[model samples]
Target: AEAGRFFCTAGRGLEPFLAREGLTLGRVRRVFSPKVDCVSGKVFFRAAARPGELRKLRSGERLFLLLKKHSPLPVSRNRGKMLQEIKSLVIEEPKYWLDIISVWRKLHGHEGETDDVSQENALALKRKSEEETNTTSKRQKTEQVRAVVSEECQVEAGETCVAPERTSNQECWIESKTSSEFPPKGSGETPSANEKLGFSFRVSCRCSGAIAKILTSQEIGRAIGITLVKQCGWRADLRDPDLEIFVHLNDIQSVVGIPLFRLPLANREYIKTAGLRSTVAWAMASLAEISAGSLVLDPMCGLGTILLEAAKEWPEACYWGSDISDLQLEGADGNIRTAGLMDKIELLKSSVKALPLPSESFDTVISDIPFGKKFKTTNDAQLLPDALQEMERVLRVGGTLVLLLSQELRRCVDGLTKCAGGDAAEASADSDSGAAPAQASSVDGNSSSLAQGGGESVLSRRFGSLVPEGVYAVSLGKTDAFIHKYRKVSAPGQK
Candidate 1:
């Protein structure tokens, strides 16, 4: 095993949360790239780690072992120069010596070349090539060497590593059975060269740089693969391999690594019914700020994603998830059973617009409301207002309601204003902006009057009127989707 630095990536807006999760793995180092859509962090875990430990991560979409991080090139260069730069970095870093040595060991598996046999062949070829006109046989060796180095480029840049020929075909990623984390053995304790592990590798490249404008991603991948294979004697597996390297190159910098986790950490095995992405669900739970033993409710719980995430984070808290759809409730039931959380979570059939629960019954309320697109019910026009009113009615003063929705801002504002007892007509007339709201329409899967309407600030004012205590919307990049956080206050005119 070798000592390695690793990084984890997440969706946009989830970098902070992913970084927080990474801290639990080891010392949090640096954010790899801030400008990219992905959030990545450098983490140092000094001891040997097992796959089980990484599987526990909640917010990360993918994890990779950092091979190198370099400053962006001053000017776009030809493939030859780029290959030269990569070779230099690997050469200067002794830590990469093990990687290169390991590359030779991996070659033993492909053509039945043993460790001793393969090195002897490479060295013999090396000598003969220096004497000859780089024979056709020598060129074949050079291509393999180049492929290994190109794979290094992929690992350097934090993009997937797949064989150049196989890049067009789907790649089957392989996980390491032996741990990558281990203290360097003393020279006396180190195994001989013959005993080292074998690994197959592929190089993948993503380009957002000036050079990228000239080179297609495939061209870059092919060139790097050819050079790396020729130089390192690394084996290439187009289908299944022991390792996959990645490269992400932008105008600002290049990132590379070997991925650790087979899938994003967000995909929990207990999830039988998947609705929102686990990352989104985790974010919703985090925003709710649940307290110990707090009573929480998701009135429109589609598949109990929010409740499941909250229950995992705050096991002591009581959770209640209800939905008007029997099918969805049944799926939530299966998931709850799979998680062995039937005792911690209560599932029921009920509509958000009219809950069967008592008023001020919950300490926290979090939900993913129908965007009026996928979650169309009978009274689509009045659904948002009705749900908000019910949520407010059941939430205790000072309780939090974190709601995710994708609808027109004006329609949402109007709905909340109406729910807060403000006359929609009066509120519209009082507006000095004089921007007419869009007519009701269907977007995504939900129906609402949210469209290309004016009066952008309407959501803030409407939230103020409804919550009174506090309110804010966390944008999720999409114009329609947002996580709306609201703290309940005494109803209008109450002391």
Candidate 2:
């Protein structure tokens, strides 16, 4: 029979990821099992069969497979025998002379006969035995020749040799074979040398069990011709480090060196700052082209986390953060100081409804508004509308606004914006007293109305024609858990 095919399955939520990684539907012939997460109700794909052509797989190959529902379940039973078989096939069978002899004995028969018949039979048996022995020897020789040819082909093609080592352990066999051909010792060489040259050294440790420790800086420095001096030591920056090495220490054996380009994570210091949750910063940064020297404004700046991250990411930016609470401002100031970014940021205590800066003062506005019953607010329904208007007022024409709003507030904001002139036309016009009145009909061909009687006549007149159009409703739970970005567009003539 032909050799069995290799099967692989995708991790949960990794089907699209696998496709992106170039895994086509046709490549996966069979799937054997699923990895089900009982708690999360998530399912992962798994391969049904061990790959016979293991050398073909890349380090991060995305494989697909189908599983037979009633396929033999994996168990401890016959495990030893199966492992022994694989070992014999991959490593011990350089020549199959002994196996050939065993087959020959099985083909012949044991019997008794009279003296005359016995003599005749003995002669026949002798001839038969010689023929069988010669045939078997030739077959063995042929296999040996093929094995050598295959080895050469693998080396020339840069294919891995997957011969087993220490019959009982699978991981040990793979590591032994890999190390024999491409040892980690001279991994510091340039890519060209690595591809062309051959090294004699091999990894001594077994590749079994959990990875314990990582390689020390001293070991890595030694490999790369750098001396590690603890006293006059260099403090390496992980972000742009030249080399990273991992040292794994086994309970029973000495430490081993693993060279890598990326370093292991040391801690979550960046993620755990006072007001600047890493997730929130990441969300805000994704909304716009935040570059060095850009202007960033956070109106409802609690703890200044967004500003801190913006300063770090866009070091050339003028970061402005403001909060209504003095206590929050104090905390934000302390955080900014601790980050060593005081020079890069400007902090102020101000109301979101009435920012101290002039109109169109910032290139981008990003904020996470307060929410829930526990959150304190000046006015329940008016809070979001007022903050959004302020955000529109401060952001430059065409600048982006990324907001984190509660489901209830998001609905209210959307309602007001949809009903209020669709774009920032009126808002922009109000910023300049020289601008003309809004057109009687909006871009959407809807008739506009001028409502009167609010204390803030400027805002009332600006949004009066649009607020009656429709109620904007946003369902927080229904909305995808992601940052929402909106661009500010000038109304006609206001541009």
Candidate 3:
């Protein structure tokens, strides 16, 4: 029941949503980033009265149990003294660290457990990180690497990654590894550059900016690893760590933590062809204001990730998803079949600009428009009004329309013109988690304000009669996006 301050690494622009999840913790606050990488936002909060409520968060990319935070860490050009101080910081509160670990074990005891298909696959994914893999496999080489490659690997309670021990019986192995031995903080985590953890553990130090000029990440990791072994009785296991301790140092502050999971909190492994981050997908659906027995539609469903996410979260609804690409439709079909939700979801092949369904048939429509480098077009700005008009046409009176688009595209709304044809096949990727978009119907007798004091904004002015309910900025890797929620006021001139 003791309160704990936890740190979560969130996608840029998501800190506000994460902190507002009604976490039983004390007030959740944002941490300043040095802006080295696209590292935009960070937040920390103390949880006690309802620490269990932390599990309610879907926007946090990865969770870290904050062991300690050294704000305004004394930095020095003298590497030796700086290393010494950080080393001491590692073992400062051994008992408290152990207690935190215990809490972590309890809180996530069912981690890697999914109610949907593929629990084993999810667990397998969580059991290792790039830092844990001994050699890169052919499959892994082709896969897109995550923003942060954690050198710290995690294992289940009983499972262990056995490998030849790299350390002697020495209590502290103070190896002075060069920066080359460790990846940069932007790339990922630090120490025993080659040490694999099985029953053992590893220390990861993410050092950036001015801190790197004086101390290498490995130096910081080693300082912590050596002290952890000498004072805290933790074993070293880089390849298979029972515990992966993370220490991040920058111009702003130094943070030390233990990862609560091996994967992002929003990560869902039930479907492999998913476009857009699962967290983002969940947000878009939340803004739909879905109610039981309501009909929901995703016109540019891509691999059906958004619909899949919505169906799983709001099962009582009849879900329909359509896309123009045969290849994409096939992929979505497979994903839907694999998730075993065929009964609740319906998939069709149709263009977003001209949906096959009749007008005013569905209760809600949510879409993640194609934009940016991943899915680009010559005149993407020119495509919005047409697709949006089609979406409005099919939406029943007073229905909710949630759109996810790039901030760049949103800004280009002023010079909009209707383009012939539907969105390109490239427009099939998107994700979101929201203000419960599809909660009790916002389309009832009166519309629900997306936020307490929400009013007409961006999409409302450029398009038809869709009134802007709420809009939230979201960070998708290098791309900046927004989730827009709207309710039809009078079906575009019905008034």
Q: In terms of TM-score, which candidate is strongest?
A: 1
> Which one is best on lDDT?
3
Candidate 2 lowest-lDDT run of ten = 224-233
Residue-level lDDT of model 1, residues 46-135, one tens digit each, is: 223445555666766666666666776544446555645543433322224344445423322333544553454356335444534646
Candidate 2 lDDT by residue in tens digits, 1-495: 222222222222222323222232225543322232111111123333333222122211122221111212122234334223222221222122223222222222212322342343344334334534587744543344234323322211101212211223222111221121123343464544322221111122222222212322222222211111110111222222222222222233222222211111111143334553343454355445577667889898888877776676568878889998888888888878888888988888889989999888788888877653334553534565567778878877767777765444444444444433444433321232213232123223443332233323454344332322111122232342224466666632363
Q: Tens-digit lDDT track for model 3 on 338-409?
A: 889889989888888788899889999998888735654434444555687898888887899888876555
Ranking by lDDT: 3, 1, 2
Q: TM-scores of the models, in the given order? A: 0.69, 0.39, 0.66
| Overall local distance difference test of candidate 2 | 0.41
Please give the TM-score that candidate 2 achieves against the real structure.
Answer: 0.39
lDDT-superior candidate, 1 or 3: 3
Q: For candidate 1, what is the TM-score?
A: 0.69
Off by over 4 Å in 1: 1-4, 23-53, 74-198, 375-381, 407-411, 414-440, 443-480, 491-495
